[model samples]
Target: MTGLMAGKRGLIMGLANDKSLAWGIAKALADQGAELAFSYQGDALRKRVAPLAEQLGSDFLIDCDVSDMAALDRTFDALKARWETIDFLVHAIGFSDKNELRGQFVDTSLDNFLLTMNISAYSFVAVTRRARAMMPEGGSILTLTYYGAEKVIPHYNVMGVAKAALETSVKYLAMDLGPENIRVNAISAGPIKTLAASGIGDFRYILKWNEYNSPLRRNVTIDDVGGSALYLLSDLASGVTGEIHHVDAGYNVVGMKAEDAPDI
Candidate 1:
């Protein structure tokens, strides 16, 4: 019931602010007694991420862009300087051009498509390879995903395609690493009003719609996601791997709008 991660240490990548999903997961891990290191892309985010990391009793922050393989190498090298091995890894990173986020998927430009795939999907693959080297005795790896990958949502656009790729990567990585005791998984969270969500067109409507129609009759919070991440990352889920766990408040099961739901 307490200190589920009492002796664990890990790195959290892509925490933008207090409201970031990464913040929720990091806090959960820390509260359960995990030592955490954070990664930020630039000085601007360092200013924001540094203080938050302090709140969790962590001063270890690494600067690296996930899209850059050399930067990722340096990041793990820096991590190795402090801790030779890691118990887990939390990858809560993804991005797409706001301009492309709103338009029809058919209109997606090749350049943006590749860029989005590189950042939103391939980054997970890149980070996992590095993290695997640090988990010689076995470990858990988690990444954030969305329901948009499974079903078409207005304006989710190419990010959905990227998430689909990410979800599949989880399966393949799990198979590749399972023999070594490394587990790979993803959380397809429901919509939340995070900085990343603000880029999607008509996002407010998407939130409201999920609120009105979901079985829970409301949206999920970062804390809701945090609790689930805690379970997956902890020893509690030792038998689970290569799974796309849904933390969407039962919304993914709905067949249609609720009969009594108010129109969004």
Candidate 2:
């Protein structure tokens, strides 16, 4: 281990299971000697997250529902009780109704639209508000985003809009926190077969399409994202902030399908 993060302590929000992007980020951080705390929303996930935390040699777990103000308050209160300050925070949370994920964007319901925005977009803001309080000494904040926010992906629909809003929030938050030496940024990762991704329609096809067309000729994995995240969260990226760094295998640069690509 490089011990690049040898003494840092931070919280990881929205980890669900082994295949989660959060899990990859957690492992990368832990391997670099960073101390970690994990947060899960409900009982079902509590069981899953506990073992993951233990695997990382961490027993600091908290129940946090970012959409709820009181739960957020309690989450940070618990964190503050344990550590007077933290060096970083990772937000890998997002959600949307599965039923709405398959249809046209025009048909998105108001309820689901609002719900998606609340969970996928605003939760970052909520958590950052509390996390910033503990970062008087300055720190790093990272969130996961996607290419769907910039280009229309079939079935990405409302979630795309939500991610767009989230990207904007990152820029604004970076500006708001820059004076404090706190950096805010995001990773627009390629499609990965995580639990949260299964909810999107024809996800497998999307994966395959990316494999054939991206400049790397493959879809990205959590490990790929983990490496990029590690850099952003570490002092390696101290000069960076408010950036939507793409970890999408160069997919964002393509204007048309590759000549060798096959139709999915």
Candidate 3:
């Protein structure tokens, strides 16, 4: 349909299922002819990713665990073997222990806090460092974030902090990789009903609130976020970097819900 990403090649991490934001972006890019490779955490995810990768005509699926350097090494190594250079990387990976995600920030256990940062924030930095090495021609790097990074979302606790750090890392990495013309940015999307989201308690409440307050009168979908992703990774957004683009149907711009509104 659209050929906006023609001839480009990108690697996408964190495609847990068809409902994933990463899947939405991948489908858009594939529709536009960007060659793609996917990475899954383990065999469980691999099964879901294989058929999807095949659907896009990509057989370049690899296993990667951000916490494991060995797995990270092999993933990029395999990509290098297939293509001398990569044009873009989509990092939709982030996690926090569900237990820590729902409580008071002050009560956060140091162990879980650090683990959250490592997985949700540090992984972005680590992956960018590796991807930059092979992007001699300069390319694009993108990560997913949330508005909670700036404002508190009741149960978003530690994950919000992690996303805040991840957003800052985007700026620093964008500056560091700038010399090479590599751009790094983030997308702060509204809530979606995905497997990962379902794990977060109180997600239903968050959804209902957004439906009533967001300017679009609805919650955002994976496709809406995907469209923004296509722009950032394409030459269309060559001048955009170190920025957090919100695809929340203008929800972030609102101060409060309408007075006459029934419960979302």
Candidate 4:
């Protein structure tokens, strides 16, 4: 419906480009009348994120490295300067080295594992802790996750483990924040061809496999994810918290390949 998020304002993190899932969610939130702020990690990404934020009517862009605690504090401090409070937060950030994404999980190096968990998982906790202060009146927080967190996907490697940690953190954060009326949840989205997905080896095959095997028999799009995200971030899901809602074309429920589907 129109104006589902009328008068609401929030931040969107981990946006890379127009094809990003963050972009999709941002468009949906803006369409429903939510004022948005975007965060980018570097100058290169600022170049890409600026135009897209403009399209969504958001000129508030902050550059912060999620892995750095000091940078995160400054990011929120900047937000506090512009808006005293916010109604919601969209955290779609996650990352791991492409080199480790292709290999076996056992082979994952200690350095990469820590880096992956810090960015892919712990950043949400750090941001949420900061955002909680801005939500003195309580608010909703949404983060992106994946089926790989629950089930194994080849080449997903350490990032999968990090997602698992992220999903668990959602529950704990929800419990911790719920006392203050703040809601926390996540969207375990299906495979989509975004800049982030490019790091996963044999990602195309994974996409085709899901397209063939999922109950919907098709791959999900960013718009598909955005719609779900809108509901979670809006008041419609006020009763929901500590939930891992799947936006994966029902792929999580399927135990085997479809009988009618051809081999990918």
Instruction: Give a tens-digit lDDT track for model 4, residues 156-203.
Output: 999999999999999999999999999999999999999899999999
Clash numbers, per candidate: 0, 0, 0, 0
Candidate 2: list runs displaced more than 4 Å.
none
TM match of model 4 to true structure: 0.98
Query: What C-alpha lDDT does candidate 3 achieve relative to the native structure?
Result: 0.91
Candidate 2 structure quality by residue, lDDT tens digits, 1-264: 458798999999989999999988999999999999999999889999999899999999999888898999999999999999999999999999999999899999999999999999999998888899999999999999999999999999999999999999999999999999999999999999999899999999999989999999999888898899899999999999999999999999999889999988
The deviation in Å at residue 255 for candidate 1 is 0.9
TM-score of each: 0.99, 0.98, 0.97, 0.98
CA-lDDT, candidates in order: 0.94, 0.94, 0.91, 0.95
lDDT per residue as tens, model 3, 76-184: 9999999999999999998877886675888889998999899899999889989998899999999999999999898888889999999999999989999999999
Least well predicted 10-residue stretch by lDDT in candidate 2: 1-10
For model 4, name the residue pairs that clash.
none
